[model samples]
Target chain A: MDLLIQIIFGLLTALIIGAAMMVVTVRNIIHAALWLIASFFGVAALYLLLEAEFIAVVQVLVYIGAISILILFAIMLTRHISGEGERLLTRHWWAAAVVALGLFGAVLLPTLAGNAWGIPLPTGPAGTPEPLSGVEELGRGFVSEFLLHFEVAGVLLTVALIGAIVIAFEERSRRRRVLTLAEEHTLNQRQKASAERAAAAADMAD
Target chain B: MRDVIEQIINTTFGWGWPGWAISLIGYLIVAAILFLIAPFQMLFLTLFERRAIARMQDRVGPNRVGPEGAWQPLADGVKIFTKEDIVPDSADRWVHLIAPCVVVAPTMFMFAVVPWGPGMVPVDMNIGLLFFFAISSVSAVGLMMAGWASNNKFALIGAMRAVAQMVSYEIPAVLSLLSIVLITGSLSLVDLIAYQGGLFISSSDVAGVPDLGLGWFIFTPVGFLAFIAFFIAALAEGERTPFDIPEADSEIVAGYMTEYSGMKFGLFYLAQYVLNFLLCAITSVIFFGGWQGPGVGWLYAQAITPANPGGGWIFNVLAGALGVFYFLAKTYGFFFVMVWIRGAYPRLRIDQLMDFGWKFLIPLTLVNIFGATIWVALTKWGAAEGLAIVEGWSPMLRWAVAFVVTLALNLGAYLFLARIFAESQAERLRVDDEVLERLTNVA
Candidate 1:
């Protein structure tokens, strides 16, 4: 059973990491968004395996629900310019890849050395293992122990609210001003045309 | 029976068939169920809704199906299936094909988390609530896909409105639940229910005769307001009645479903009802104290007989079955209410819906959470202080105060929402006027 879990975890981790990379590296922004969703799903599955039900759900909610759609909408709005061409890679692709590779090696080489690296593994998984009872224990901890952090999250949300309002209001105003100006321009043109018609009628009468 | 036969096969063969083999079996099972039971359920629900709404409207409905319209949905299904599977020449073939799948799959996946009974669930994930939210949200992507893929102007516009509505509403939905989770402290649906077992009810001491009351999350005021918040969110999520702007049949001509047909269209239609059912079920579980009953233990005990003396398993099964029935009944009740509202209320404009979600639901939910947390903490403190005196009075008083506060806030929120809705509608009218003028000039 342990071995089965291990294999599943290993496969999941690889898939998750690969998908994470693909999200950034993919040429098509839409495809990239889809890849990011795959990565999020992979992470959610990992959270499930770890028995972090709430976190997993939050991950899926934020990433897939809010973030992915936001990205999709952004992509759609910008589609006229970017089109379908997967031009996600910046000018320094090789540099980025080399840096990534170096960072991977730095972590992987020592990890491959295993015991020689001298990092201690506890009798159980490091950090507070998520309670098997799920939300009940998590709730208790959140309310009593991490109450501070939980409250901070509320503050963060407030900030988000303020930011959303500002942006929305700004956008609304900009659209309104432009629309009013355009209306005025059209009205002016129509008036000019009528005046010209009146002058032509007078000429005909004369 | 066939179920016994399948059980034998499953036990004997085990679940370790090759991935493809297992998947093939699962697929076949799902397809069979969908092909067989889905149509029946869809038909029944349709008839049920029609009859229910008709009663609400004080009229007899669908009495011709099969002695009071029993077979109406079946006839409807048959008609839909035999209808031509029209594909617009201008539509993108692949995306169009996949759109219904996207819409349908998420709704279907939501059932996996719902506990119909102890072992009756398909996939009992710990993050079941989250899973439901995640999967349901993806339906918007499907809507967008359907809209974009169709290449029809109406479909595209409808899809945009849908995507916007869903995205805006999603936050308030999560935030509303976040408040509940704060009090309950767990994400597991089972755990959430368990927390509510005792807290769901209190003895009302009217003349010293302890009145055993309804066990529900909505009993408390914050819980009650939260229930309303959750209900509105669920309604919008399911695209019911006032919130059913996505498929505003009168306006967009089936909205994003403009180009879909055949089995694919069937999938989307099935998903719509399934999602509707799920939103109701989920609401029941979260706010109505799922599976809690009076003398549930006694009910289980009564299930055991002389022939089944050591039938602890039987009792377990009975209890689970009872829970399933209760859950389903509550869900159906909610669905009936939704249908009733649909028959009664006018559809909301897209801007109105968004304003309701963001300007109203979001702010109210946040305030509800703030008030709830403080209220819970204060009540707990009171219980601690008046440990001896507050023993009998604790649940009742706590609940009463919570109930009053929640009701007040809900009313306030509604008024606030009305104002916002009015303002946004006026703004939208202004925009519409500009657009109309431009169109007239261009013409």
Candidate 2:
């Protein structure tokens, strides 16, 4: 079982790294978004390997399902979807490399030195190993123990949503709305009726 | 399944197969069976929909292929297979080739968590419902890829509408299911079914109740509302007619599928019908009690379970057959309703679709969730949960009160929302007319 898990972990790691690289190097903006989704899926699989099923499913649902689709929509709506002829590297590439290397080292050094690796599973009263994360326990913690944090996070998200709507809201008076075919027909009919009435009034005057 | 296989191999045959090997074989067999079942369902559903819809339109549908046109899908499959595969001149070759597989694979994976019969789930994951929906959303990416890779304007428009509709409706769909999850307090499909095993109320809700296999969630007001919303959302998600704007034949020439032909088009068709089947199956499973009908539950109790290993194996077979019968009946019943809807209603405009999903269905489901919470508090809670008023009441009396309260609340909310929504729509129309009149006068 351990061997199987290790093998899966190794494969997932490779997939994550490969997809991440593709995200940066892929010429098409849409393809880069696709690669990003693949990278997100790999992370979700890693979560599953760690026995965090709830988190894994949420990662797929929120990131891959919602966020990546949003990103793709934005990319598609833009002018250059294929990103052909775009420069792969900016002029200050070395500066970016320095920051990237420093961030990677900062993340890796702690993990390499940390003593918390390979911790044993917590046991229940019956001496059986408990799941690393259970859905029910997580729910209980959110509502009871972490109630304030949960509410704050929810409020923050709601605020962000409202802010987005406000920014995107167009003024009704200033907006130029396109009429549907039915509406256009109604407008045309009204104009033709008024025109005929004007002609009839002029004829009566004559 | 692993247990059964181990018993046969290690005990009956005295082969002493290892546990992991037995489990692996069991999973492989289950996966193979599911793969077979998925495509067969797609084939049967295509024929079923055509025949049913044709009957609605007062016409005979392909009755010459086989008896009642049973082999029609097979003939169609052969035609599609023989047709030349075509890729557009400027299409992205690799993405175009891979998109169909991406779309079809998730529908197959969804078979993993669906409970076909009692004790017949493939994986029975703790988060089965969540896993199902999550995997389903992955197909949206595939649709986008298909549209973009095709390099066709109509295909791109169709894909955009498809993704937008799916993303919007999924909110209401998941929210409606959330109410059920809140009431049941579990996401496992099996647990959801097990909770519905009494007369009108669940056996889990009230003890000592008879298991007549009639404890469907639709009997309750909250469940009824959720079922209505979820079914509507399911129609949108499956791209069935009335919500099939994504592929409106009159509009954008088959949507994202406009650029594909031959086997590729066939794959898209298969994915669609398979998805529709799954949506129906899940609807039945969550609301109508999958595999939980008369005589099946009683027989299953007497079968060769771990608790009663000495029981006859005949009961197991009997229970499984009856359970599967009930499940399929409910599922096909839903598919028929989908066809009936397609025949009855014209396709909704895109704006109307969005308005219905966001303004009407989402609010209705949000209120339903509140009712579900109240039901839980009344039926399950006592002084320990700070509901001291319900502490002295009997379970049946509390249940009655909860049902009555929730029914009133839900019905009232529905009527109020409908009135407001109608008024808002009418007001918008009036405003549009006024604007048109003003513009006419200016001219």
Candidate 3:
């Protein structure tokens, strides 16, 4: 049973890592986003295997739902650069392939050889065990054991939110300057054209 | 339940090699069978939703496939498979290709945690309920990926809104479940069901009964409120009507799935229907008594005992079969309710949705939890003090109380709305008549 679990976990992890790598390597931004999602799913499954169900759900909700969509929105807004063209990347394909293969070989060898040095496996059950780490358990644990860290995380979130607002305000001022500059140039051009037309009319009358 | 499966398999096939290997093989075989049937089940669910909604709207839906368009999904599947797979010229190629796969995988993974029948679950963990929540939430990522990868502005916007909506609504869903968890004092889905039984009566009383029947969670007022919240949240989770702004057909043209075609599109469609089934199943387990029918326990014992003359693989198979049927019925009933609502109501605006979740649902659910906890605490304290506050009530009286409470609440709600809107009683009555006429097919 342990071996089977190990194998399943190993396979799932490999899929996740491979997908994550593909997300960066793939030419298409959309495809890269998709692969990243696959990686998130791999991590979620790992969380389930570890019986950290709440964390797994949180991982999915935050990373997959929020981050991926934000990335997509950014991609959409940058319409001029987002379009696909053949050969966006230019690299020595053979050398890159060889390096990738060599890296995989190096990692695989140690994983295969280090089997004997395995950590102590969970003895009770494959999934969640008795005195289950439920929401209530986590809640109690939060107030007792990890209260400081939880409070710090909350404080960090607030700081980040405030920083975002300040940055946004700065960006707003910068955008106003750029907009006024463009408006001034257009207005000057229009006035010059009108002056030229008036002078031509006077010369015709003379 | 999983232990029972291990024991049964070990006793019968103990002479084999390692017990673990045999169990692994057994589980894989079961998974294989379920995988084969899952697609068909998804297709049927779609048809059922379509037909039920059509009936609610007094229209005939998809009557061209097979008998009553039963084979429509199959035909649709074939069409999707044969269609051209478009790789958007401007889209992120890798993310686009991986998006549907991402969506499908989490949905499939969720099924692994769901128990449809007695001793039929693939994995019966102590954190089964948590497992369900975790796996179900992962689909949001897939959806987001799909939206992002599409490279369509509409898709991107829709995905963002959907993510926000799902995340906010998830709070109420979890809180509602938390209330139930408090009552049951367990996270395991099976244990929670057992606890509900133990709460209402003694073990001896249960033993005297046929299936060790429990008072269903829906019977209590607090439980009923939780059930409503769960149902609404689930509809939002599944991107169903009223909460389906993320995929509003007239506005966004299928939202995140806009750029998808061929089998890729089919996968998303398949996932949506399966998700509907999954949500219904979860609601049934959490809110309703799962597979808790009359004489079910007795039949289970009779089918499993060695001394019983008729006991064999056949009886065991029958038990499993019945279990599956009961589970399917419960899931379908919930799905039908969703379909009915979809036909009856209009979609909500995104802002309205966010407000509904954070403003109304969260506070309402918190109130429900407080009420349930106080009720439980009072009952326990009373028992300890030898003053019975609630022992038993006549069924008729209980039903009457329910009716009077509901009527009074409805009247209060109506009066409040009238006051707030500054509408006269005559105008309010007119609006009520119009709604009633619409419901009764007179308008």
Error of 3 at B113 (Å): 2.0
Which RMSD does model 3 reach against the true structure?
Answer: 11.2
Fnat values, candidates in order? 0.44, 0.64, 0.36
Residues B316-364 of candidate 1 have per-residue lDDT tens digits of: 6677777777777888889888987898899987766876787778888
Which candidate number has the best DockQ? 2
In order of listing, the candidates' clash counts read 8, 0, 14
Model 3 bad stretches (over 4 Å): A1-206, B1-15, B198-214, B301-319, B379-443
- Please list, in the order the candidates appear, how each scores on TM-score for chain B only: 0.79, 0.98, 0.80
Better of 1 and 3 by lDDT: 1
Q: What is the TM-score of each predicted model, taking all chains together? A: 0.76, 0.95, 0.69
lDDT string, candidate 1, A108-169, tens digits: 98888777667667656576654664666776798899999999999999999899778756
| Candidate 2 local lDDT, A1-206, one digit each (tens) | 77988899999999999999999878887788889998999999999888899999999999998999999998886746354876768899889989999999988987789744667566546785666577889899999999999999999999998998899788876889788888889888988999999999999999
DockQ of 1: 0.31
Candidate 3 residues B1-443, lDDT tens each?
33456666667766545666666677787788768777988888888888877888888999998899999878878888999999778786766887788678777777776766555677776667766776666667667777877879888777777777777788889888887776666777776554444223322213332235455677666677789888999999888998999989888898998999999999988888888888998898777766645444445666754456476666667766776776678888998888888988999977668867876677767766775565444333344556454346443343344434533443454345446444443564585455434433421
